[model samples]
Target: MNMSTMNSACPGPFVRRHNPCGHRTGQWAQILATTTAQDQEHFLVIYHDSDTELLPAEAPEQHYEFGPAPAYWTE
Candidate 1:
């Protein structure tokens, strides 16, 4: 996964391959933040351009896996 700095400016849920300094897009999941809730074990996180948007002021870890979903904890 491409490593982008999660900061107030950089924000959460950026395009999987974006430079962060500018608005770019591709066929990728725009990740914002990730939080484990309930007892589910899998890729659980917030995405971009959605209702549950993570504020840019809050830095949060973000990423995405392209291949067939891993065995849950793999992410």
Candidate 2:
């Protein structure tokens, strides 16, 4: 996906990204502010369009791999 940033007359730079699943789907979001909720730091991003939605962000410590797969001839 391609991301673009606008340098308009705003406090923070406006960021926009296109949805990879849809050709004409895209969204623009800006970092409105930052605050701590329940002792966890969070960023407040406002979306200008409804083409996309936001999910709860998480910080994963490390990546784990699934074990080796078994080989089977027939299904």
Candidate 3:
């Protein structure tokens, strides 16, 4: 797959790093499937760690929540 074109929908070229606990960090993982739950779409994601065997079960290193996309600003 093209790495440049990948976005939130695609898992990524993970980096090797260490967490606070000195354990090996996991690859950057994105949602592989989309489903409906809790009155909203469910696409669970996480950063893979050696401790977590499953990608879907891993915990994200960071969680980013943003407001609606902003349009081009004009004065």
Q: Among these predicted structures, which one has the highest TM-score?
A: 2
Candidate with more favorable, higher TM-score: 1 or 2: 2
Q: Which model scores highest in lDDT?
A: 2
Residue-by-residue lDDT tens digits, candidate 3, 51-70: 32222212323322212222
Question: For model 2, how does the per-residue alpha-carbon lDDT over 40-71 read when each residue is reduced to its tens digit?
Answer: 54334455443333312222111111112213
> What local distance difference test score does each model get?
0.30, 0.32, 0.31
TM-score of each: 0.23, 0.34, 0.27
All-Cα superposition RMSD per candidate? 13.6, 16.3, 13.7
lDDT of 1 at 30: 37
Candidate 1: misplaced stretches above 4 Å? 1-27, 41-75
Number of clashing residue pairs, candidate 1 = 2
Which pairs of residues collide in candidate 1? 13-31, 13-32
- Once all C-alphas are superposed, what RMSD does model 3 give against the true structure? 13.7
Error of 1 at 9 (Å): 19
